[model samples]
Target: MTPAPPKNFHTSNPETETAIDRTIPDFPAAQLSDEDKYFTHHKPPSYLPDLEDEVKEFIEYHQRNTHKRIVLVTSGGTTVPLENNTVRFIDNFSAGTRGATSAEYFLENGYAVIFLHREFSLLPYSRHYSHTTNCFLDYMTEVNNKVEINPQFADEMLIVLRKYKQAKESNSLLSIPFTTVNQYLYTLKSVSQIMEIVEKKAIFFLAAAVSDFFLPQSRMPTHKIQSQESGGKLEVNLEPVPKFLSRLVDNWAPSALIVSFKLETDNSILIKKAKNALDRYQHQLVIGNLLQTRKKEVVFVTPSGENSWIKLTDDQISKEVEIESLIIPRVIEIHTQWIENK
Candidate 1:
């Protein structure tokens, strides 16, 4: 069942009482008055499926049952909408191709994937999650091959979609499709809450070119805006969008190996920028994404000074020419090794 959208803030919200005695107990403080109005007026959203208590335990069971580990994978790009109504948005160059292709690789490696993707042009693996308390996975040693086949490298994903068609008859995954920065924030917060509850070490990909800033002062317009973008510059107050790395490492999934991305404009300072990211988030690796080009980039800055500066440059102008082929393998190597270290 879809839950109601978060509540509107008021000075006298009874739920805010942080006293020792309460049912829900210690709910987060209300947002700034500005955020209060901005969020409440918007429609509430449903999330992708969560693991049943039984399913979560089953993941644990699979870990013990098979001795292989489960890792969470999140990808895709975020959106920043222009209006309270998300009809129009300022989009980024991220097409979720990197994230989707990487996810396919992870699935091919036989790891359970807890995908938290946004605007993924590609689809995810099946919904028939195995037994676990709030988890989804399937393990096979001499696994059978009836899982179907298609363009997707991850047969699991293909099977899952077709299965969803059979089970839900075209019901889509819980896509909290957000176009505004706030809308993305709202959805991301819920994702953080759930990830925090998860105990395993996960592999999170910050492939999404999350907007650095968002409308700070959003209010219910008495009338709808005729246009979202204008020729001239009209400034709007904005707040920082949430970054999952710091919070995820510090509080949410400390055990889960972390891999982050850094997008740089200047090539000379790319490593410096990546080092800053490593210091900022304390991640194991950072994929440096150069702006404005899709050619296989200077893939560097993994672990304490170790890196792959190999340039798989593009010549022909097809989609594959612009994307990273070894990106997935390099990530798989680092994560597999990281997990082995632990």
Candidate 2:
């Protein structure tokens, strides 16, 4: 049963207002493009220096293997904070299933993976255990004063564990966490720039469901919004998030194979939007999927105006075959051709 919310849960006492001024400031128009203005005004995440250092170290570790391929897999949904202190925020429905699953396949195919994902979202190897109906502890049993994997789950668990161990032993997988859209954009730019040394050997698998709108820092309230302040009404005005795919394709990781995802509820416009994104950003590929059938099928759109569908048969779906198992191999095939042509 759900407990009732506390009284005045959404309101604050009028007399208890803090000293921080809540005035909305006016600003003059700027000549800068929305993308330029966004990065210019919004401060980078405080942990960016450490993140850059970590990425650089990861890349340097793999630098000795000139034939190695690296894929940056962005995953999960980005949050749009409503206030500077962030008591409330907006989020999408993505659970990072596609990205996490694809990362595992990429690792299996011998490509180094940079898994940039939302905090607490599903990850590649551990995803098999998390976000499931069974509790993680349920997969274990105690016998003879020792904890052991339950025989029922041991077979599958062993396979995932072995793969996870191999990835760790080889240091082929790097995980980066981001929560807000701002952090994701900054981290993506920094990581892509660092990956520039690899040239055509890198792949940017942009699967993250980024927010299309955001509450700008300059406009965000300093404190949690109070219902009493507005007489039980609240209004929020969000600014359009600057599209950074062009910057990513043109400036950051220019020689890399950039594959972006296009998710739509309407199937009719899915291919159109996917193709448009490729033409606009000049990216290598776009994976289009319907919201309802994403797990069963996906359409690949390339700049050459060729489109193909990858789908799971009823038998495959019933047997729990993941579409990413097919998607990753096709992406690798395209990447191989792309590298040779370059």
Candidate 3:
């Protein structure tokens, strides 16, 4: 005779339990909005505690110098995992060129930078050599059994290296990486809250290309889906990602100067959508750029209905001048004016 099952174990029939487990219930539409339910139901990332500690330390270090303004620059793209175990994922398109370049300029303008970026994306200083046709090895040479920067690239590399070292020595640049959308959201919220110590001196540059939709954790499969079991055709249902910009503005870092980027394929509706975001979020500025012309031009949209275009001249483009070089200075000007007005 077998020993009795534990008292805590369910005595329900196996078939009934299996049937109930297969049914995934939809969220109640009348009770709560998806956004509200998201935070309530979803669990925070496992690495959040470690991330918070690092951010707190970084912020505390800068707080010692009251005059130092800190900018939290988010870069690259977030991924939406298809499964709980994460065999496949949906990703946004961003090489982190804008955020990385903007960060260097922010540092040059005497701001401590907290770079919250997607894992493995291009980074400042190193970004100059990454994601290019040539490999990093192409810029290296082995002479007298010692490795050195190739002579052709040494001059440019030297300038970037000096700035990079300066930033490191001053302890002004803090880099934090996130991979999935969940991790990104958690990290952003935690970092922003910690930045409250700096109050009006903080700036949030939200340049990351975040996904508009994602599979909720409750509905995700525990293991990777087998193609054979599904008859070779796969269908996925995704829910709209919460609009957290409003939360960021109203709750997270209310006093911080917030700047968001809008990239669109259509020129006619770009300004309209940008203005909508500004009105909706009540943020300071929206930087709008077309997908095709983002490298050469961008429009600055403000909450007060002020719209201005920042474009690179033909000569500037030919000279390989990055548009962020111009974008950052204008942003700094606006930030200064905003701080003074407040």
- Of the candidates shown, which would achieve the greatest TM-score relative to the real structure? 2
What stretches of model 3 exceed 4 Å from their correct place? 1-34
Q: Which stretches of candidate 2 lie above 4 Å from their native place?
A: 1-31
Per-residue CA lDDT of candidate 1, range 1-342, in tens?
A: 122222332223434422221111222434323333334333434332332232344345545554444445445566655555556556665555565555555555655555555643344433133222433323322236554333333566556566445423312122224434454555544444344333334566556567776554344333445545475544455566545456556644566667777777887887888888888878788888677543566566865777667565445334444344566667777777876787
Error of 3 at 170 (Å): 0.4
Q: Per-residue lDDT of 148-258 in model 2, one digit per residue for the tens?
A: 999999998899999999998899999999999999988898888789888899999999999999999879889999989878888889988988998788766789999
**The 10-residue segment with the lowest total lDDT in model 3:** 1-10
Q: State in Å the error of residue 90, model 1.
A: 2.1
Candidates in order have lDDT scores of: 0.51, 0.86, 0.85
Clashes of each: 19, 0, 0
| Prediction 2 TM-score vs. true | 0.89
The candidate that achieves the highest lDDT relative to the unseen native structure: 2
- Candidate 3, 136-227: lDDT as tens digits: 89999999999999999999999999999999999999999988888888778778878977888899999999899989888999999888
Question: Ten consecutive residues with minimal summed lDDT in candidate 1?
Answer: 17-26
lDDT score of residue 299 within candidate 2: 96
The local lDDT score (0 to 100) that residue 252 gets in candidate 3 is: 69
User: Candidate 3 has which clashing residue pairs, if any?
Assistant: none
Q: What's the distance in Å from true for residue 201, model 2?
A: 0.3
**Ten contiguous residues with the weakest lDDT in model 2:** 1-10
